[model samples]
Target chain A: MKLYLGVAKDIVVKRTIDRRDQKRVLGNLYDYDVVIKYEIENFKDQPVILDLAESMRALRSEIGVNNQRDVEWELVADSTLTDKLDEKKSTADQAVFHVSLPLRGKDDKAVKQTHTIHLRIKNEW
Target chain B: MKLNGILTLTLALLATMPTAAKNVDLSTIPPRDTVQLTIYNSEDLTLVRETRTVTFKKGVNPLQFSWANTLIDPSSVDLRFKTHAGELELLDTTFPHDKPQMLYWAVRSEMDGDAELEVTYFTSGISWSADYVCISDPAEELMSFDGFVRITNNSGEDYADAQVRMVVGTINLVEKVRELAQRGLVSRDEAKDYERSRRKAGAFKADAKNELLSKLRADFAMAENAARQPKKIVKEGLSEYFIFSVEGTETMKNGWSKRMRLFQGHNVPFRIQYRYRPQEYGEQLVRMFLLRNDTVSRLGSTPLPDGVVRLYRDNGRDGLSFSIEQQIKYVPIGQEIELNLGRDPEVIHEWVSIRSWRNAFWFRRHGASVYYAPGKGHRIKINDAVVGWDEHQAWVERIRNYRDKPIDLQIRRSFDGHVVFRSNLEPSLNDYRSPQLTAQVEAGEKKELRYELVFHQGHNQKQTNVTLESVN
Candidate 1:
C-alpha cells in the first residue's frame, strides 16, 4: 500500500497575545500570536517516516489567509514539531504551531479572524 | 417603437357588459410613443414613464397593463390622461386575483377619439456610477480631466429609444424598491390603501415634476440643435438633486452597461507638495497633487460625484506612464482635491537620535510618606529611594530633494506623556500631542531639522500633553 497523509478536520485556530517575555518593550513588533492546533492522519500499511521539514514549508500560505496591513503572520521556527509521524494512526495525535502577528494603536485590540484556513495533503513518493 | 415583449397592453371595450364577464371585444396593443427613465444613483430605483395613444369609444373602456418577468413595483403603477384629461375619467383600478404582475384601469370616456395616455411606475436593478480619467503633463503643473458615467441595466426589460436621466442625490425610502418588486402583486385592499396614500401626496409631487419637466425640455431643445456635434450631457440643479440628461435616445438592453462622457477639461492647473504624515501614510514621505474644484481649475460648473480616478503622466517622449489609481469622495465647488501618489524615491527623509540624558530626580523617603525634589531645603538621605526623574532626548531630521524643481515639505511628529519640545526651527502644535513643521527645499539640496524633547516621568509628570517651545 502507498503512503496516505491527510489533514484532519479537528483543527483549532485562535488569536492570542505573546507571553514569552516578562517585560514587553514599547513599540515592539510582533506582539501578538496566532496559535494553530493541527492534526494529520496516516493510513499506510507500512510505517512511513514523514519528514517535518517539507511539511512546514507547505503550511505558510495555508495560514496567511487573514493577513492585512497592520496585522501580519510569521511562523515560529523553534515551536514546530521536528519529529516524524508513525503509520496507521487512527486520529490519536496532534501538533500545535505559533505564528507571530503585530498590532498597533487602540482600535486594533479587538482583531477577529475573518477567514478560515483549509489545508490539504500532497503526497510525495 | 415596439415594446420588445417587456410590456403588454390590452384594451377591452366593456359597453353594456357585466363586471364579471370574461369575454369582451379586445383592441390591438399600441406601440409606445415616448419613454423616459429617471435613474437615481443613491438607491436601486428608477422611475419609468411611457406614453401611447389609444382610441377610446364613448363608453367604459377597461385597459390592462402587464409587466411579466420584470422588476416593476406593482403598487407604484399609475395612469394619467395626457391629452383628454377633462373628457376621460379613471373610474376605478383593479388587480385581479388570478393574474399576477398586472393591473387594470377602468376609463369612462365621454368622447370618441384618440387620447394620449401616460403610464408610470418605479422599478429596480438599474443603477449608474461615475468615474474619471486624469492625464498630467510632464511638468505636473497642468492636467486633462475627463469624467464618465456608466449605466448598468439588469431589470429584465429592454429600454429602446428612451431618454435617460441620472440623479446624483440620496432620497429617503421606507422600503427598498427591489423588495417591493420581488413581492409580486399586492391584494386589492392593500393596493387601494397605497393608491389613497399616493393621492394625498400627489400635489407636492406634481409641482416637483412640473419643474423638472420644464428644465428637461429646455435641455432637449438644445441637444436637438447640436445633433451634428458630439454627444453632450446637459446638467441642471433641481431642489437638492443634480440631474444629468444625456443627449439623444439610447437603447439599453438587459444585462448591458453603457458609458457616456459627462465632461472634459484641458489645461487644468494643479500644484504638487510632499507630506510626511506618519499616522496616515506610515513612515514614508508621500508626494501629492492638489487642485481645486472651482472655475480656476476649469471644472466648477457642477459638483463632482464620488468616483475612482485613474492618473497617468506624460513621459515627455510621446508616451504615458501610469501613476496611481485611487478613489475620491464627492468634491463640492471650491473644495480642494488631494491625490496622494505614494512614496517617491527621489526624496529621502531620515530621523536619528543623537543624545539622551536624565536629571531632576525626585526621591521618596522610606517610612516618611513624602516625596521631594533634590535641594528643596530638605536634608538628603542616602537610604531614600529615587521615585521620579526627567528624561531629555534630542533628534535630527534630514530631507534630501533630488528633483529638478523646488519642493515644499511638511512633517508631523507625535509625542506622548508630559513632554516639552524645543527645536531650532519654528514648530506649531498640530494637536495636543503632535508638533508640525513646514519647510521649502531647493532642488539637489539637503535640509536638516533638529528638535529636543524632555519627558517627565513618574511622580514628576504634571500633565499628559506636549508643549512646543522655540530655542534661541
Candidate 2:
C-alpha cells in the first residue's frame, strides 16, 4: 500500500485583528484542502467492514483532523469483472479519503501551521 | 472818485494773477504692467520688480512713491525705464525731511510721451518653502512622491496677477533686510548726496542702477526658459542658485499664503532602511525610506528642493504617519534622498557599557605665593602640584530584528571621543567630519559590537596622543 498525502501545503487567508470588528485586519493566512488516500494492490480477499471503520478511525486520530465534517471516505471502484459487489456491501477493494482542513489558531483565526500526520499500520492476531 | 478807481485797480490785479500749479499726488499710481516676485527660501526676503508706463511732462517731474504701512526697504528701492533709456532720465530720489515713508523721484524725460518704467525693491515678510508627500508599496521598493511649494506674503502690498519665482540659495546681505525695512530709515548723508546730484544731473546713479541692470539681465536670461512653458514651474540654475518660477500669475494679498503643486513621481523605486543611533535616538530603531533622485530611479530630471515629507504605506489601503520636517538640503540630480520616518517596532536595539577602568596619571600647577622683598614691593614664587589617574570605558551595542523577513539594519554611533580600540562588526563607514560610525545588522538576528575608550587626566600631552598610547 502506498500513502498519498495531497494538498498539505499552507494556505493564507485574511485575518482580522479584532474579533468584534472585521474592518481592521493584518496580513492574510492560507487554508489547506487536504486529501489523504491509500492505494492497495494485489488483495486476494475483501477487507472486513469493521477493519475499514477501524482504519479510518485510527487515521482520523493520527492526522488530528480539526473538524468531523471535513473528512470523507468512499470505496474504490471495482475494476475486476469476475465478481460484482453488492450495492449495500461495506467491504471495499480500495479506499479513498478527502479532507478539508483549516489551519487555525485561537478564536478560530486562520494561521500558518507546520503540522505533520503520523500513520502506523499494524497487524495484530 | 479816487477810492473807486483804487478798488477797481486792486480787483483787476487779483484777476490777472496766475493760479499756482498743484503738486502731483503719489497715491494715484498706475497699475503694474508686469510684476515679478522672487522669494527666498532661506530668509524672509523677496525682491519685487514691477513695470509701469508713466506719462512724464518733459521737465523735472518730482514723482512721489509712498509705502506707508508696508515692509518695503527704502534703501533697496530702485526705479528705471525699460524703454526710452536715453529719452527718459531719472535725476535722483529723495525722502522728505518731514514726511515719513515716502520717496520722490526727479526724472527728466526728453520726450513728453509715456515711457515703460521699472521699479525694483526688496521687501520683508515674503517667504516660500517646499514640501512633499510620499506613498510607498508593501515591499517598499516603489513609491509615489508629490512635491509642493508654499508661498506666504505679508509685505503690506497686494500683488495682483504677479509671476512668482522661488530662489534657493544664500544671499550675502550687509544688514538684515527685514530689520532695515522695519527701521524705515536711510542714511541722511546718502540722501544729501542724492539731493545734490539731483541739482546737477537727472538722477544719482549708484547701487540702484547697478541692481536694476543686473536684475534686468537675469530676467532676460530666464525669459527664454519661462516663455517655453506655460502653467508650470520653469526650473533653471542661475550660477550658484536655483530658481523655480510658477506657471501662472497669482494674486498675493497681504498676510495670505498659497500652496502650489510642483512635481509628482509614480512607481519610483526606494529602499527601506532601519537606523539605530544611541546618542541620537535612545534605544530605538528609526525606519527611513531611501530613494535616488535620478533618471534611473525615475526621478533625476531636476534637483529636488528641501521640504517636509509625509510618508504613507499603500497596502491596498491607506495608512498615514506623521510628517517629517527636513532641513533645506538641496537634493542634487542623481543624489540619494533619505527621509527618516519615525521609529519601527519591528527592529529592537540595546546598548550597554560593559566594562571600564582607570589606568593613567598626570600632574597639575597651582597659584604662586607672594612675599615682601628689599627692592621689589613683593616677590612671587610659583608652586606646582601633580595628580594622576586614567579613565577607561567599554560599550556594547546589540540590535535585533523581530520581523520575520531579513533586513539590513544600519547602526550609527557618534562617540564623544575617538575610539581607542574596537571589536566585532567591521565598520562600514567612518566619517570624521561628523565623527560618526556606521554598521549594518542582519535580519532576524542579534549583533553585538564592543568598543573600548580611554581618557587621560592632569596631562599636558596632546589630545590625539591619548588614543595612540591606550591601544586596548
Q: Residue by residue across B261-280, what tens digits does model 1's lDDT show? A: 98997889999989999998
Model 1, runs deviating above 4 Å: A1-125, B1-5, B16-26, B187-231, B356-371, B375-392, B414-419, B454-465
* Docking outcome class, model 1: incorrect
Report the Cα lDDT for residue A75, model 1. 33
Q: How well is candidate 2 docked (DockQ)?
A: 0.01
Candidate 2 contains a number of clashing pairs equal to: 15
C-alpha displacement of B323 in model 1, angstroms? 1.1
Candidate 2: residue A31 Cα off by (Å): 66
User: Judged by DockQ cut-offs, is candidate 2 incorrect, acceptable, medium or high?
Assistant: incorrect
Q: For each candidate, give its TM-score against the true structure.
A: 0.68, 0.61
